[model samples]
Target: MKFLFLITFIHILPQCSGNPLSRHHTTSEEIKREIARYSDIAKAIINLAVYGNAQNRSYERLARFVDTIGPRLSGSKNLEMAIKYIFNALQEDGLENVHLEPVKVPHWERGVESAMMLAPRSYNISILGLGSSVATPPEGITAEVLVVTSFDELHKRAQDAKGKIVVYNQPYISYEETVKYRLLGAVEAGKVGAVASLIRSVTSFSINSPHTGLQKYQFDVPKIPTACISVEDAEMMARVASRGTKIVVTLKMGAKTYPDATSFNTVAEIVGSKYPEQVVLVSGHLDSWDVGQGAMDDGGGAFISWEALSLIKELGLRPKRTLRLVLWTAEEQGGVGAQQYYQLHKVNISNYDIVMESDEGTFTPMGLAFTGSDKARAILKEIMQLLQPINVTNIYENGGGTDIDFWVRDGVPGASLYDDISKYFWFHHSQGDTMTVQDPSQMNLCAAVWTVISYVIADMEERLPR
Candidate 1:
């Protein structure tokens, strides 16, 4: 028995000795070679993106386009118009085979929304109904407000929440945690027979404009009216309630939901010369919330992607693999557009060389998160070394963005470019997200990063691992 065990251990040790993790590590020599190969191209793309005359022209055109179109909520007529505009713009940008794929999306109308305190220090407050929230009666629901910091606290005192407006005054910690209250606070409040629900805007900044996002209704509970008030208004309500005063809130919202409507995911491709079957995909969503002009939330991202491809073509660089640009719709409502695209093209997942998405607001580019095998990541690190001079240096392991989740799950490795998100969440889903809020210098920096990344992926010799 001892001899048999010794033999098995010896065999396993030799197998473990051949582990790739022990042998395959990023080396300075490899990085230096990659930098030498791509540095000139990276420098050229960066110059054009940040300081070139062409970039200025593109920026002005994009800013004007977003401003003119204004808000384009999912499945709305404005969104349809925006889709058409994007297709035309891509065609004009010299991209071939620009087309739209049909996708079904939910339609939620934000007709009118208002809320105010009726006791203590009476004040009108800015608010907006969360997408998919049920409308209050014609007269609106007036009830004493009950404030809680978390769902656990609400669960603890749920019995006392009857006939009151449950106000979730939870502070924003991170997008992962704060998003829970925005997505499901209504259902939690409704389970306890609350008349309505109001969540503090999911942002750290105390702007007076409310942030709006998608909300979900549980099947077992009645759907209650839900809205979000700005952090300032939420604090004021909390203060009034703390004084032991009967804080009555009058909320009037005409928000309602309609049947799913037809939307489209627009795609434009630059066919490759040698490896026509392999693809490098880049994109941003086209739909935005109804409050602002949708400039920073996604308009900037979409335009930068469009401009990057245009610049690549204008530079007369013909890639070896197909380069595709997608302007997805209904990303705000859900990832319906992305999911539909993935399903419609599931057979091509293996042929995708790399997918890159830029939905993290149009701030200065930092680096990129890679979600793939160590082999693919090692190759990506090589590419990243070329971008180091431009200050894009925060590559790490992470999943792809929401729209690319489908591809990533199906073993298609992808990346979501990182940007300086220090202030992005502040105005992310709020009316504060407008073209006026963007800094041209920072936007230019982002454009530079996008151009380099798109070009590298397009020209790569090997496809990323599946």
Candidate 2:
């Protein structure tokens, strides 16, 4: 069945070679030989990283860094230290052009914040102020609660939300779908004159822990204090409100945003042996929320990206095109670092061969999500087959990371590591994102997958079609 699937896929998909005008060179025989050679090398790299001395060390290094640095919120000193740490580590590893590119990032500090259920049996609720949220009045606001699941419901019951605290008890269908509430809860609630808002944490399951994330308030709308509450608390409020019991809550917060501060996106590269100016880039965001150690959220992503280059350099392998590692800062505040990097490099965008990012947790390797033309996709399909030994053969289209969105829009092929995120959202922006959730074997496998794909793509005779 697998063989039949492969044969059918190949026949249906277009092929690409060194140049689009010279497609005749991408015949099956040549592709097969290329696949065989690269597959052997990739398998060897995977085995060396997973079963050899490199095993477990990647996770250990990441744990130590994250534990030592703690949370690396944008514009914080911790973030700068993390960048310096990676920059020095890359230099010590002998990678070339190890440097930091400047980017001014927003500085949001979460001061003392708390929420309490005042009626229907007093209960202290776990909460974390959403990023960029306004603080409640000095004494805080105590008001009856308005419970709604969806934005449509919020609109329908807009009249009832006036002078009340809107509590969004939305279900966690998926991160992409559920996060909409967290991102726009304040704007939606404020539009209806809500004094404050609390959103159900964006996670399938929670342990009475609230998750904090970035939320934006529309300029035209009134800005209101917003925070996330644990799933249990959200559901309990919803049940109480259903019974027509007035749910009163007191919300107090000291969240504040200051002037943008200077930060950096750390970059290091392994120069190519042949196409020196051409580049294959692998990246991950470095800045994270103030909560937790930021380990799984992005420390894992950034370190695994670093480990890819580290392993390649250690093994004494140089590809045809340069391999660049980018640890973007201020990503938690809406890709500020990445946007600046894109604007600065937009003129030379064509020089980028491919850009890959690993922002998801470094869980077991499930393959990659790709964004490119059909010809490029075909090449990727062939490349993914080499990862089959680790059960990472999946590759879908129209996928990449937030940091690479601008480049992908500019017609550059982009990719993001796909992993089993079944439990990622649970700890994602919460205090649960410590190093305890990481697995050493999975980290090594993630590094191996990233290394092989990047090396093979950089060494390929042609860049992926734009």
Candidate 3:
């Protein structure tokens, strides 16, 4: 049946397009037949991935990486070691053209940090200093707390913000909506004459754990120390202030930034059997927050991308176009590694056929969110139909990853895996991001989908239209 399907697809190819170089050659029936052929191949790849070493190694290797190496913060020794490990692993896996590309990354260390409530009964508040935050004075600053739910409320009470520690208890509506507080909490509070700022973790659900991530300080505004507190603590303090209770807290952080550290973007490839110069890029960031093991955040992402290449190599399947796997570094620090990579390779951007990232947690497969021209989207939508057997057929437009944003902006076809990440933000940047949250079966399925999609794209008759 598979042979017959391929024969039919091949026979219809020239009749519709006359040449493989030109796209849009197939009639509706030919397109349907081609899609069916691709679907059958995709199922074969999926089966190979599911029963192959990726299912076990993707998770087990990540467990070892997290347990052995711990967090992979940019400019840290751990991240460098991670690059080395992955580079060596890829070479050992028989992936061709494996090497490390240098990137200078920021080094921010989270030293002794603490926050305490002195009023309304003493409580040791759980807090994680935001990455890159400046340390408070040696003695720490003790100030009255000003609680506000929104930036508008802060603007309204600007006068009261003077000499106070602004605490943003912004309720979590969605990650995209609520994350503004986390990113700009310090700048907004500094603008309002606040001594410091603390934002509730940007997650709809949280335990007593405090999540930490990168925060920005506008150069024109006063720099202030900032940290994230657990949702329970933020709400509790908000309640205290609502009852006219004086909320006073002491915050001390030892976070300090050091000189830029040298890092690398790990690269490996399966050279194309035909168009070796035309590249299909698949990637995930290697650097993660300092808090927990970066298992779910991106260990799954990086490894699954590697697994895609590994499965392809082990299966002796070579695409018509090169499949390049990039393990990006310093992504948590505003996509610094990917930025450098883009700068170094922008001249060849046109040769890039597609760039796919999996920074989002690799949960159950749910197709992809893509950003491309309408024609490209149509082709991808049809390709994704092959994945309906696993219920991952849904495809949406305007989807890409932070690392690949530059490529997408340059009009290169870009995509990222879409998964049911309902609990992703909850554990992101927190100690809860360890392997405890990862499911092996889910990781296997994610690897299967990634491998099939990237392989099919690389082996397609023509590159996706820009």
Alpha-carbon lDDT, every model: 0.80, 0.87, 0.86
Write down the TM-score of every candidate.
Answer: 0.91, 0.95, 0.94
Model 1 TM: 0.91
Candidate 2 vs candidate 3: the lDDT winner is: 2
Give the number of the best model, judged by TM-score: 2
Q: What lDDT does candidate 3 reach at residue 408?
A: 94
State residue 427's C-alpha deviation in candidate 3, in Å.
0.3
Question: Which clashing pairs does model 3 show?
Answer: 16-25
TM-score of 2: 0.95
Q: List, residue by residue over 136-222, the lDDT tens digit for candidate 1.
A: 888988888998889999989898799999998897899888999999999999999899999999987865878999999999998
Global lDDT of model 3: 0.86
> Model 1, residue 306: displacement in angstroms?
0.9
